[model samples]
Target: MGDENRTGMTEFYFRPFSSLPKVQLLIFLILLLMYMVSVCGNGTIVLIVCTDCSLHTPMYFFLANLAAMEICYSTIIAPLTLANLTSLRKATISLAGCGIQMFFFIFLGGAGCVLLAFMAYDRYVAICHPLRYTIIMSWTVCVSIVAASLALGFLVSLNMTILIFHLPFCGTNEIYHFFCDIPAILHLLACSNTHAHQVALYICSVINVAIPFLLICFSYAFIVVTILRISSGAGWHRTFSTCSSHLMVVALMYGCSSFIYLRPSSSYSPEQGRVVSVVYTFVTPVLNPLIYSMRNKELKDALSRALGRKVLHQSK
Candidate 1:
């Protein structure tokens, strides 16, 4: 089903991993476990934040949004990846389906990036300016930040998707990577004079990934400075504890994404890109809930209470 037209491309096929069947099987199993964990883990975070009254605050509000984004992010790619791995025949995706996948992948990913930055800001306020933290991070402001993050994410992703898909894919219908990401798609483009397109992609990456990452770092820089100014050892420990989880999440999300998107398309390697993509797309989501739950005692206690209530209701 490899037909090309003047308007747009129709469908695309995915290249199977070059490894042996046993290796493919192992990869499939690992991806399956990762998918389940990402879903369940992020799902639990969302559920606990929603049901637990104690978690009804700006920090947890942003966290719930992040968890929801992670769930959506994993769902967009992981299931299709699993199906492709298990299928006997080569995996094919319709042009419309491919566009949709790319859209959500970028959308949720961008939202998560901004959301993490907001979480850092949240901690910054809570720690560095504890006196006016409540007034500064009111419920109204929190909701506005979330709405802005979602809107900004959609705007950037829409621009990138439109720009990438507008190019003709007349050469090869086979995508070398596991998913329909920008770098992978650009690598398959049969067009000439793609310098402008690549430049636009790099710009988008800079604005979305690199900038937010810098903002997170900036917020934490101030946070660390403010923490050190305090004399109490307990104060230092408490301040650091609040932000450690967010810092870890920022490192994981930005590290892989920046590597994939921040560079020129000429440097794109399908095999390396696929492996690195696994980090942010699959592994990071699974690790996020674990990182947060493990580091945040408040979250752990909230989870316990939520589970306890579930057990109590079921036993009745």
Candidate 2:
């Protein structure tokens, strides 16, 4: 505790991934490949959404933003992690650095949750109320929704970061995981009693994860009802197809995050935490582009057109 008084700063060093000592190199290589692919894939999605005239619609617009978020969120964690892996995980981050990382990560994550719900609502409007979809989801409205999602994300993230970092963090000075996750920081690094903070964090998790998930479910229920009402089987298949990718993403994200955060802090095993963090943090981002592109015909078509234009121009 005197370390803070002496230096006027608190620094948290990352404890090595002790659970897997033998395979850090292999893990590094795999993560590097996955990170590269994720960046490229999501970058392509963003570029396509921006340049392709055919993709200038509400759904694609939301998808572009989602891709951008994945890129940023993953970048914030992956590069530093990869660098630390090279050193076998003796990474030190200052208090301010930790807070900034947490804030942006939570900001992007919170916004993403809300954005997914909005995408569901978008689909609901398109299918359930096609006649008014244009009026309801106009360009101005879409921009406002994005703005609001970001604003809410910013405020919530700011609040959580403030709540956690406001207290004096003293103890082992070692975070067991790669990044300063809320639970890891709260449980492992905090010097004082954090029961109140834990409770507040849990409530925030419910609001961030549960409410949006419920909204998605509600939107889908209407979408399903509307789909079933369609007289033709093809219509049923077509409508459902549009939602499958988003559902997969929702399942992957909500499932992994809920498993980590929504549970009691008593069960926070450093080993388990790191592994699960790998899933939601690294694995999900890499899969997102593949999920959306492989499932959606429009994205693939736009990609092909872009590639063809590049090849032809190069040949010239």
1-316, model 2: which lDDT tens digit per residue? 2444236546777776544755877888889999999999999999999999999999999999999999999988998888887784487888788889999999999899889989999999999999999999999999988888899889989999988887666657888889879988887777778999999888888888989999999999988888878999889778877999999999999998888889889988878988999998899999999999999998999999999999999999
User: What is each predicted model's overall lDDT from 0 to 1?
Assistant: 0.87, 0.88
Give the lowest summed-lDDT range of ten residues in model 2.
Answer: 1-10
For model 2, what is the alpha-carbon lDDT of residue 179?
89
Report the lDDT tens digits of candidate 1 across residue range 1-316: 1233336567787877755788889999998999999999999999999989999999999999999999999999998998999888888998888889999898889888988888888998998888999999999999999999999889989988877777768777888888898888877755655778889888878877998989898998998899879999998888778888888998898999988998667788888898899899899999999999999999999989878988999999
TM-score (all chains, Cα) for each model: 0.95, 0.95
**Predicted structure 2, TM vs. truth:** 0.95
Clashing pairs in 1: none
